[model samples]
Target chain A: MEIKKTSLNKLHQSNNAKFVEFAGYEMPIQYSKGIIEEHKFTRSHSGIFDVSHMGQLFIYGDESLTEELEKIFPLDLKNLKQNCSKYSFLMNEDAGIYDDLIITKIEEGYLIILNAACKDKDFEILSNLLGSKFKMNLDNNRSLIAIQGPKSVEILNSIINGVDQLNFMTGNWFNSDNQKLFVTRSGYTGEDGFEISITNDKAEKFVENLIEKGAKLIGLGARDTLRLEAGLCLYGHELDINKTPVEANLRWAISKSRLSNGGFIGSKKIMNQMQDGASQIRVGIKPEGRLIAREKTKIFNDTDKQIGEITSGTFGPSVNGPIAMGYVDKEFSKVDTKILLEVRGKKHPANVCALPFYKKNYVKGVN
Target chain B: MSEVKFSKEHEWITLEGDVATIGITKHATEMLGDIVFAELPEKGSNVEKDGTAGVVESTKAASDVYTPVSGEVVDTNQAIVDDPSKINEDPEGAAWFFKLKMKDQSEMDSLMNKEEYDKFAKESAS
Candidate 1:
């Protein structure tokens, strides 16, 4: 297959980005300043990310559409106010996650932002489920740009004008540069930020305007460090077909009302897991020193018995230490529980720690 | 102090009498990015030519640091192990990985000089 490039490919080139093939797309892994510098810059200021490879699935329908979606997702769509968004997952009958997504209620129906790798499969699943009763469009004409960090609000609001009023996990449409942009107050970096949906043709100029406003373009390397520090899950790593949302420690995303009724797809398995408790559960890990336990590193108990494996691990720039997230035996998933990580044939001490190693205030509560 | 010699593995070696100091070149550090952790060969250990003598981990990944020539490990730099960022900051100077007592000094004769190494580095990178 031909490697795909985003509309901002030229802009990334101008910034001296080092490209890497990600999910079949030629994407920047880091710029010339490198991952550490780009990470620090984002934490101290603003950083823009090009997420155009993700699918922007707009399903147009009315009240019936909301009712039908409730049968598939665990969210209470009827009670959800317009413009409000919820973090959710698409799952199989056994409750194994297919993808983690953000779905927002719009005037027409709903807008779902899906992971790049799983978008096609998710669209197919949804199409088969809905059976063509609702109009679905996995629009490729739009680009998703996320501006994150402390200074993101001020920088993005300067151009969009009304984005500051949007609360976390909410979105609204606004006219900017004679084009309609769907602006949302959400981001993966756990900072007060916004994700702007705009036309592909306007992406380059729009990003240039952000660079002019002091927001530098960060690449996938820093993006990984930032999100890991924030304790957010990446699709293929932290959640996959073999992992359930309950086992992944994301049961909070499931609606309480739906849990009791158990009508959603995979609801039976989800309810059973919620009651029986998953044998293995996800938790944050802090290595004793500077040793990085990369993905697939074996996790062990004090007795040398293998308990689990690391899913995502890295040196968190803001935390100034190594942080990781992985599934461990449910008995060993408590905070401060001692565990051993096997790196390069040597066992090292580690402890289960609370996530979001770095904390910052988010603009929420409006929804 | 002697003229620094380059190895195909990206290590630079400088001989002073029977003791030779070794460190990764600046180009290596540039390629590796911000190094966060380091492990060194133990003192009094004997290593074979081109054998793994240490490990350095950047933010992105972990890579082995190989010894360019066989020797008995006389000393290992604890400074780089204590703070690996120095390897990226001053890799060729303050970040020398180890010092070895030469097992066979002829191993240095096969190494590249500064000019030959510059060409090799360029061609290999391209």
Candidate 2:
């Protein structure tokens, strides 16, 4: 199958970026500055990401629409105020996750953003569940551009006035230079940033403006390392249909009201599992040696018994060491607990560490 | 006089008498992007031509450095081990990985010349 190219493909090529196929899209993996430099740039300055491949879905209905969504998702949509965004999961009837998404409560309806690779499957699942009951629209013609870094606010403020007033996790309809945009102060990277949903036709021009303002274009390679350092979960790696939020260390995303209501799909199984405690819990691992603990590397106890497997691993630019996330037995999930990662038949010692290996410095405007 | 030979895996070897110094080609380092860490074989270890002698890890991926000629590892560049980015900065000169005592001088005949290896690197990139 032919891979899809984004509107910024030409720009990436002209800049001599190394391209790699990711999630069915031919995207830039890095540029001349390379992954380490790009990762550091986003942490210290500002970096722009071409995440246009991510799926954007809009749900519209009457007053009962929020309640209807709560039935399919595990989010307490009723309490999610308008213009606020919440991370939630769409689960199967058995409580296995279908996909994790960001649900933004808009003025007219709900805006759901899903992983690019799982877009088609998630659309089919939502259609099969809420086809006749609600109206759903997939905006495939739009593009998502994430401007991330500590200086993101300054860069965005120069382009769109009053955006600095918006707080984290809130979104607003933005009008700039005759272009309409849905601007949200949300990002996958654990930095202060904005994900701007723009029309495909206007994406190039918008990206050019940001680049002219000194926003370096980062690729998926840095994106992975950044999110991993922040201890954020990726869909296929840290989460799958069989894994619940409880096991993924995302219990905070589940609202207290929803826990008692038990009205959403998979709630019976998920709630029960929550009460009993999840058998496997996701934890961060920092290797003692320079050798990285790559994906599928088995974690073992001191006696050499298997405990878990690494889901994601890399030399985190921010942390300046090899960092990884894996699922281990609940009893072995304590911080500073020593474990061994078997890589290439050799055992490398590692320590269980806390989430967000790098402390995030999110920019907060003066209140 | 020293004669430099290239391996198909993009490693370069400079032979002076029976001593041979090895490192990844400048082209290979460019292709690998950023050099973060390297795993060098211990001095005195045996290595065979085209065999995995060491490992070079970039931020994005890891690659094995194969020996261009069979020999025993006599010395390693601890400077590169302490600062692997030297490979990215100067892949040909100061970034040589290790030194080996040549087992057979004729082994150099199996390697490519500088011009031939340059073309090979270009073709592989495209």
Candidate 3:
């Protein structure tokens, strides 16, 4: 099958980006500046990304739409004010996660943003759950772009007005050159930025305008390292159908009202797990040697007993050392606990560290 | 004076008198992307041809460097060890990984010349 190319494919190619196939899309993995430079650029300056492959959906119905959504997700949608967004998940009957997503309560309805690779599966699962109670419109034609870095707001302010008023996790509809679009103050880079949802017809022009305004286009290579350093979870790596939010350290997404009301899908099992604690918990690892502990590396205790496996690992550009996140037995998931990572048949000493291995500079005053 | 030779794994060795200077080729450095770190063999250590001599790591992947010719490592480039990006910037010159005292002169003939190595790199990319 032919891989789908993003609208900015040519732009990336012109900039000499190394393209790679990711989630059925031909995307840029790095550029001429290389991954380290790009990763540092995002932290120090501004980095733009073409994330149009991510899924965007609109769920509309009567006043009961939020009530119906509450039945499937564990978030407290009743208190979700308009234009505010919440990170949530779709759970199976057994309380296992189907997919993790961000749901924004829009003016007229709900806007759900999902992982690119899990889009179809998520839609099918949500459709089967809702079943005639709500109308679901898939906006696959719309493209998504992220402008991330410390200078993102300053760069965006030069073009769009009133964007400074948007706090974290909030969104607003805006018009640019007679084109309608939605902008959200959210990003995966752990930096303060915005994710712009634009029509396919206007994506090219919108990206060009942003680039012309001094935004450096980053690729998947840097995006992975940036998020990894931030201790943010990638969908397939940190979360999957077999894991729940409680195990993935995503308890913040589970609202207090949902814990009390207990009306949502998998609430009994999820809440029970929350109360009793999960068997395995995600923890960060800082490897002693320069050799990186890549994905699938085994984590062992001092006694050489297998404890966990690395889900994501890399030579973090920001951290300047090998860093990883993995699921360890609950008993060993304490801060500063020493562990060992078996990399290439040799054991390297590691220490359990705090999350967000690199502190995020999301809003200077807020964070 | 002897001509430079390259291995299929992209390592290059140049023989001058009884000493051979070794490092990765430009093609290899470009494919590895931004190199973050390198593990080098200690000076005065013996290595065998076609054996693992050291390691080179990029942000995306890590690979072992094989000794193209058997010798005793006499000296190592401390500059590349300090900043691995030198391999990406000048793989052929300043990025030379190590200097070795050749144990067998016949081992030099086993590697390919510039023309053959260039062709091999192009075909392998395809």
Candidate 4:
């Protein structure tokens, strides 16, 4: 298969980015300043991420569309306000996550942001479930760019104008450069940021403008470190076909009203796990000293019984230490629980800790 | 002290009497960016030629550091283990990994020199 490239491929190369193959696309791993510098830069200043490879799915429908989607997702679409967003999961009958996404209610219908690797399959599955009743376009002509950090609002609001008024988890369409762009105050990094949906042809120029406004381009390497420090989940690593939202400790995302009625696709299994609890649950693991227990590294009990495995682990530049997230037995998932991580054929001591290793600075409300 | 020799594994070694000091080359550090963790072989342990003696981990991944020649481990740098970023800052100087007492002095014969390793490093990277 031919490797794919995003609209900003030339820009990344010109900035001396080191490339890596991610989800079949040749994406930049890190730029000239490297991961640590980029990660820190995003925390202190604004950093731009070229997330164009992700899926921007627009589904247009009427009143009946909301009714039908409520049966598929566990969200209360009837009560959800326009231009507001919610973090959700597309699941199977067994409650296993197909992909985790952010769905925003727009003026016409809903726009869903999906993981790049699973977008095609998600489109097929949704098309089958909806049975052609609505119009769905998995847009390839659009590009997604995320600008994140402490100074993101000031930097972005300068160009787009009126963007600083947006509260977290909300979005609105604005006219910029003679085009309509859907700008949302949300991002993967646990910083104040915005994700902008713009036409592919204008992406490079848009990013260059952001650079002129003091935002720097960051790569996937720093993105991983930043998100890991924030305790966010990645699709292939923290979420998969075998993992359910309940086991992943994301039960809060499921709407309370939907839990009682139990009409959604995975409601039965979800309710069961909610009541009886899951066998394994996700938790934050902090290794003692500088030992890094990477993905698939085994978690063990004091007596050497294998209990779980690490899903994501890395050196968090903000925290200046090694951090990891993994599934441990539900009995051992409590904060401050002592656990062991097996790295390079040796067991190292670690502790189960509360998530968000670095505190989030989200702008929740202005009024 | 003598002229430093390099191994294909990107480690540099300098022999003084029978004690040979070794550390990963600067080229190796450039390849592995932002090192965060390190582990050294135990002192008094005998290591075989080209065997794993230590480990270094960057934010991206972990790599096993290899010994170019067989010897008994005499000293290890605790400073690098305490602060691995020094490996990125000065890998060739203050970040020397370990010192080994030679099991066979002639074991250094086949290793690459500075000019040879430069060419090898360039070819291997491409």
Candidate 5:
């Protein structure tokens, strides 16, 4: 099957982007500046990412859709305030995470933004649960662009108003003339940023305008490195159908109210993991040497006993060294613990570090 | 006088008397994209022709560097190991990966010269 193209596909080509097939879409892996340059630029200044392939669906109904949604996910959606977004998991009946999603409470019902690769299955899962009461509208016509860096607000504020006021995880639809833009102060890069949802016809122009204001166009390669540095979980890498939220260090997304009430799908197994502690936990690993211990590299302890394996690994431009994250035996999950990663048949010493390899610089609460 | 030869795997070997200097070709470096790390075989190690001698890692993935001929690793380039990006800068010269004392000079006859390698690279790309 031919790969699908986003609205800004032509723009990426014109900007000399190196295209790679990602999640069934012809996405840019990096521009002419390369991944290392793009990664560093996003950390220092700002970069624009075309994440339009992500699933953006709207579920609407007269009565709140929370009751129906609660049965499928692990979050208490009933109390989710309007315009506030909560990052939660779409869990299966057996407690495995189906997919991680962002559900923002809208005026009519809710809008769920999910992983691009899992969109089809996730859509089916949602439609099956609330199809009778809620009307699920898949928004394919809208393009999602993430503007991230210290200068993100300055770049975006020039085109629209009041976007700078939106706090992290809060979204508001801004209207100018006839075009409506939904801007959210949330991103994967662990930096101050905003994700703007715009219509297809205006998407290219929107990106061009941002470029004119000095936002470099970043691609999937830098996006992966940036998110990895931030300790954010990528769907296939850090999460899968077999891993529970507790194992992936995502218990924070499971609200206390939901845990106490005990009414969400997979609540039994999830609650059990929360109470008893998971056998394996995700931890960050910093390779002691220059060699990068990529995904699937085995992890070992001082005695050379196999402890775990790396799920995602890369040379972190900001960190100035190779970094990785993987699941390890909970007994060896403490920070600063010594570990060895076998890369290409050679063992390299590594240190277990705290998550969010880089400090988050989010602009919170109207800052 | 020196003569350069290419392997099917995109490694280049330059022969000068009994010693051969080896590194990945520019074509290989371009395909790998922004090489971040290089693992070279230790000095004095014996390597078989077409055997995996080292590894090159990019941000996206890792690839093995195969020896084009049987040889004893005489020296490894510590500079390229210290800064892998040097390979991207000058893959054929300053970024040379290692030096090997050739076991048999006749192996050069089986390798591709500059002209033949160019044609092979084009064919492989297409």
Candidate 6:
């Protein structure tokens, strides 16, 4: 498959970024500073990431759009306030998760951001389900950039005003030199950050401006570690068509109203799992030693019985240890449960622990 | 004078009389990024030329460390295992992975010397 390039490709090359193929795009995995340096910098300072590859879809329709969307997803759009963002799941009939997305309710319609690799599939699903009910507009002329970390607000606030006061999970338009920039005070990294959507024509200059203001250019390498440390689930890893939200430990995204309302797709199976407790549950795993157990590493029980497998694993720089997230039988999924990881034909000891291997440092309301 | 030698897989070996110190080349560390974990072969283990002796893991992936020549492991550097970052700090010197006693002295002729290995490293990168 031919790989696509973002508008900031030239800028990344000029900045000495190491390129890697990701989601059909040749993206920078890291710069000269390397992943560890970039990861640490983002924790203490600020970092800018070119997330243009993500799919941005705008849904427009009449008053019935919300009800129609709620029927297709396990989301509670009724209480979703205007200009607020909510994380939701796109589920199939089997109660399995098809994709995960962030939906922002606007005045006229809704803006949804999804994973890049799942963009075409998501659009096709939306069209097939609600083709006559809503108009789906895929925004390709815009680029998305995320400025994240502790100093993100200070760095970005220096260029655009009032962004420092934007609460987490809130989306609004800010005018900059007559350009209406849609920004959300949220990010994948467990930090105080903002994701800005700008036109392709102005993306290069905007990124250059952020770098000039001390936002170091980070790549996908550090981005993975940051999100992993935040305990955020990547679509293909922590979520899959065969896995339900309740099994992935993402029940928080489903509100109480939706569970009781019981009209969404796969609501029956989802509620059943929630009530009876999922057969398997996702939990954090910390390996006993320095050997990092990567994805697909099998997990074993006390009697050496294979119980589960790791879905996502990496060396978390902030945590200063190897951490992983995987699904295990609900009976063995508990804090401080001893588990064995089969790595390279050897059984290494590990323990199930609380997630978010590192503490989240989000800038919520009044924080 | 004893001199440094290089293998096709980017490992480096330096012979000082009967003992040979082995470590990865500077180019290898740069390509691997930050070194997070390292597993070295145990002392007194018999290994063959181009055989996997240890493993070095970076944040991105893990790579096997191959022995440049057949030998018996005399001493293993536990420092790199205790703190893998040392390999990134000084891959050719203080971070030498292991020391071995060469089984056959004739094997040294097959390895590339300083001048030849420099050109080889540069060519392989391109």
Q: Give the number of the best model, judged by lDDT.
A: 4
- Give the clash total for candidate 1: 0
Candidates, DockQ: 0.91, 0.82, 0.75, 0.89, 0.80, 0.87
What tens-digit string does per-residue lDDT give for candidate 5 at A204-264? Answer: 9999999999999999999999999999999998899999999998889988988876778
lDDT of each: 0.93, 0.89, 0.88, 0.95, 0.90, 0.91
When 4 and 5 are scored with TM-score, the better candidate is 4
Candidate 1 overall lDDT versus native: 0.93
| Cα lDDT of model 4 by residue, A265-326, tens digit | 99999999999999999999999988999999999999999999999999998899999999
- DockQ, structure candidate 3: 0.75
Per-residue C-alpha lDDT of model 1 across residues A280-336, encoded as one tens digit per residue = 998999999889999999999999999999999999988999999999999999999
Rank ordering of all candidates by lDDT, starting from the highest: 4, 1, 6, 5, 2, 3
At residue A172, what lDDT does model 5 achieve?
A: 86
Per-residue CA lDDT of model 4 for B15-90, tens digit only, reads: 9999999999999998999999999999999999999999999999999999999999999999999999999999
User: What's the TM-score of every candidate structure?
Assistant: 0.99, 0.98, 0.95, 0.99, 0.96, 0.98
- After TM-score superposition, the amount by which residue A159's alpha carbon in candidate 3 deviates from its true location, in angstroms, is 2.1
Model 5: which residue pairs collide? none
lDDT of 3 by residue, A1-367 (tens): 9999888888889999999998999999999998999999999988999999988989986569887888888887878889899989888866788788899999878999998899888889888878877789878779999999988898887777767778899988987788777999899888999999988878887788888988899999999999999999998898888888889888888998789768888888788888999999998989885768888899999999999999998889989888889999999999999999997678989999898989877653332
How many clashes does each candidate structure show, in the order listed? 0, 0, 0, 0, 0, 0
Instruction: Please state the CAPRI-style docking class of candidate 6.
Output: high
Chain B alone, candidate 5, TM-score of 0.97
Q: Give the DockQ of candidate 4.
A: 0.89
Better of 3 and 5 by lDDT: 5
Stretches > 4 Å off in candidate 2: A363-367
Report the C-alpha lDDT of model 3 over B9-106, residue by residue, as the tens digit.
89998889999999999999889998877878999899999998888989998899999998999999988877887899999999999888998989
TM-score per candidate for chain A alone: 0.99, 0.98, 0.97, 0.99, 0.98, 0.98
Q: Which of candidates 1 and 2 reaches a greater TM-score?
A: 1
